[model samples]
Target: MSDSREVVRGLLRPQFREATPYGAPQLDVAVALNTNENPFELPLEVAEAVAGALREQVPHLNRYPDREFTGLRKALAAYLQAQTGLSLPIESLWAANGSNEVLQHIMMAFGGPGRSALGFVPSYSMHELISVATGTQWIAGRRDEHFDLTAADARAQVQEHDPDIVFLCTPNNPSGTALGVDVIEAVLAASRGIVVVDEAYVEFVRPGTPSALALLGGQPRLIVSRTMSKAFAFAGARLGYLAADPAVIDGLRIVRLPYHLSSLTQAAARAALEHSDALLANVEELKSQRDRIVEGIASLGLTPVPSDANFVLFGGLSDAPATWQALLEHGVLVRDVGIPGHLRVTAGTEAETTAFLNALAAVQR
Candidate 1:
């Protein structure tokens, strides 16, 4: 090893020896569907509102924001109440830069050297990454070949590990499997620690699907996290929030930095929350495109995992990496999520989805 490499390795923790920062390819391509982002832009009125909110904050930028983020918390609570009909108090709401940061706060508060976290594999890799980064032991749990977790299996594993934190990702990442409430309840009954339901893509779920937010009442250990990045079409704003018991929010506050949320982020998110109804209209359109990808890939003879998320995880490639490259050559980019014969693609605009389906078909030929 080079002298610089040797010195850095010796200075860092044992886990830091070979860890790479989390990211996907940032290539310039005609179509980008790697990240499961809402493809729609903000409505004109909402954009103007955000700009106006920021303008109002220019004078107050000299002062630190409310350390408690009181106004933003109220806005978030209102938004959640409108969406879920669960009228949680402002004390039960919390916000951070992204869902990832919200999760990091959870880990810092509840997970550490002696404590551990458990998550089903091929789910959100960040659950594992964040666990390790926080000095928490990460236990990789199991999933069936279809990437689905059953209530019985989940209960068995929870009983086995008895970890301090458990992550259950609904409409799970990469595989796009949506766990039923039965599975969530089973895991909760079995785990003695925190249970986080990552609902970053919950907005795109098919009709009649239930959100875990409904389970938050009388469930102090349960946390339901949501992001503006996906359904709200405010990915660029980097706002993610969660609803839990007020006591759980108290634990996060002990770990969060003072004024961790900026005045600008608070302003932008509150403005966005005011026009949330108009912003979320685009969710129906994206859901339409998501279903189209599922059907299109299935008709092309590939296997698509039934998705309630904005992305589709399809299988049947002999070489997923080669197929990903081939699709890129056809001017489309998709995620090769490290599964042996499967890849994931985000649903974009109508033209973007058509381009992906066409490019995928051409590669198969």
Candidate 2:
């Protein structure tokens, strides 16, 4: 074991020799609330439709999938138009296995040695991980104590770094609060590079919160990424997409492996998009439960960061790690997120939420 470990350390890339793979602890618990996944399974009608589409593709598996995923792109464009009221040309759309891959593709094309990527700290950790993985320099900017980014500070950092790529995560992870369009616009106005806005949880955002999709028009360097995982309950389908200028899409096309999206993935995603209305019907319920978590945790004297996404990040824990372990012993799993005094929980089904709150209450006592 010692010799094998030494060999791996010697052979792997210098940066990755000590890096850990990204994932949550896959644990068996009565109620799991980590990872911010939509708690509902697909509606039966949608499931049947996706299965039927995949069934039709089985016989054609011997051939590669449509390299451009034309049909899926059209479906995605229509869905985004209806959802955002922005009619974008299909040429502006692109997809990969997941939103992380979408980020990776952008990095591959635009970010490399000597190119730098800037993201606000305590935002999405993946923004840093993917940047470093692509050999792009990672620059960590700061956020306010409440996890909010001000337009002035955002512009200042962008100007100071002059990064080749800037990442903005709305309704950011680990904190679950959202950014306004002004913040995004400020970054765009300040920087000379590409701006990638990750909206992985937009469907669950509270009312009146605008999306960056509204800003994509006339901004050739802006890329808005979305996922079917959170709202469409299609995480298992591994489909994530983005909208950008046709030129950005073309650049990503150059770096993408041929036939990168599998035939089954494309079919499943399109079928799921066909039922976007039904699949998203539970957003209200999830939002309600998310609010419940905020109130429930606050009622117990823990300060939950206000959330627009389906998860809540709460602080005021005297010892977050101990509380996390206590909740696990009670069969409820949440994320510690490595923050000093905060833990994050996904808003699950009503019953699951109840279990989490109850477990925390017990731990508190």
Candidate 3:
């Protein structure tokens, strides 16, 4: 109709004019392992419970959902307490459609023109995307050659940038390495503003790794963001939440839209949380498969980084893009994260893992 798309582009913000949306390729492949999603499907009993809960709320669709989502918060608090042995109050919990939205709410409340946020390079892409969208300056800090941050290095970077918000991604994505608590504490001490510890993959962490939730008390500016999408196999449910001080949670409330959570979402999440044990029964199995992938790739002579998360990032490819395409030709899909020789693959069931390994070995030869 008259170059409406061009007209829209001409009126867009300068910073966004050249920006492309963030997403991995969504292709129909025999084995999909790109997005780091939990490979297991929800247990049938849990799914049935979610369906029943949704049906119970269907009649009340005409009414607005509980704006505070009080019940969901209580469930989350209880879940955290049981998981971490931390006595979390309901007021310390907040949730959104997904952790991305939860992050947006934090940015809206604390970030804006003239303020800056800093994050280590090659972490979650969305952290920078959201910062730019909210008009906050995004500062890219460097990580070491191995993608690991030491306490001294982290503190130095934070002190140098003096950003208003600092992001720490544990079990960091695209690399699958978890940060130690000392590194986190060092950054917190160095920065004078908010410190967001993104723990979306925390549930898959190796044994003996501690969660940031244990550091919540007395650190008013610390926020730990988590998601059901990864470990709980609730990616389809779109439920992400954060644990922080009550004051921090209160700030998010000011930025969130009214009744941001729908009745159906609340019901489904609550039902899943009720059967947390059954829902998480496959975690060990996934961990085993993850180990298998590491071993299989290594046996082929590829360099797979030691991973604490459900995905593995490997290097040693002569050309990552070419290998990615070759793997796809074999009906297997993995993530080419723009790193020169690295690609990321999510751990799937034993059969899926076998298919991926076979495809990779064939492609390598």
Candidate 4:
């Protein structure tokens, strides 16, 4: 081997030469709350159903999966209708390995060399990373002091950047604040390109927070991406999807690999969708735990942002990295999102929440 490191560096894309991979720390700890995974495992009933569905597919493994993933799309459409009462046509849906990939496909179609993407800061980091990976220029926008984006502010940024794609994250990551419908409309009006509303955590939004899906009917350029990772507790399955105009679906088809979804994946996702009610039974309880975390953290004299997602982001630490290490020492792990004085923790089972709170309190003292 002739200097493997140098050879790899020479072959790597210039833009990616200095980039780090996107991920939260995966550590073995008594409590792992870094990534916002659903704390509950699949219920026995759903697990059995998934198993049965997968078993049925083994006999047909010789054949490639449905190139269109028709059944999976229909099931997803049905689930969305039941959950959000949005009567979306199956043609309006698209899915891939995860919402990240779904977003990547969007960038492939609409963003690339000489194009650009825009997202507000402290939102989902993946938006920018995916854009850069697609050779699209990334523009960082602004949010208010409290991490909320106003319609006027959003429109101003859109006008200034005029990117080929705009990413708006509802119940935005790291901050956990949901956007208003007005903000979505304003951004749509301001942008001539595809606008992606990332609702990855929408299932946990507080009442009165409407989904951007409501605005999808008239706006052909609008795309709302969601995932089963958080609420359905299906992160390992890696099924992320988006809803948009049928024309947008047609565009995604051009970029996706043929039969991108495996037979097992399609079958398992369909099975899970069939039992969505059962899988989602834990949502309210998880929301309760999330609220408990917010209140508990606030009671400890830390500043916690109001959340519509399953995690809480709190500040007031003397040193966030030191606090993260201290919490890990006490058998708890939370995220230090490179935001000074801030840390994010997922809502776990009640006992886990209590343990985290107690650990945080002890560290504070």
Q: Identify the superior model by lDDT, candidate 1 or candidate 2.
A: 2
**Minimal lDDT window, size 10, model 1:** 77-86
Task: Write down the worst ten-residue block by lDDT for model 2.
Answer: 228-237
Q: What is the per-residue lDDT of model 2 for residues 223-258, given as tens digits with 9 covering 90 to 100?
A: 999898888888888999999999999999999998
Candidate 2 differs from the real structure by a C-alpha RMSD in angstroms, to one decimal, of: 0.7
Superposition TM-score, candidate 2 onto the true structure:
0.99
**What is the C-alpha local distance difference test score of candidate 4?**
0.94
Misplaced by over 4 Å in model 4 are: none
Q: Model 1, range 1-365, lDDT digits (tens) per residue? A: 69998998889899978888899998899999999878788899999999999999989898999888999989888888887788989998999999999999999999989999999998999999999999999999999999999999999999999999999999899887788999999998999889999999888888787899989888999999889999898888999899999999999999999889999999999999999999999888888898999999999999999999999999999999999999999989899899999999999999999999999999998
Residue lDDT tens for model 3, 197-253:
999998889999989998988999999999999989999899999999999988998
CA lDDT of each candidate?
0.92, 0.94, 0.94, 0.94
Looking at model 2, how many pairs of residues clash? 0
TM-score of each: 0.98, 0.99, 0.99, 0.99
| Model 2 regions lying over 4 Å from their true place | none
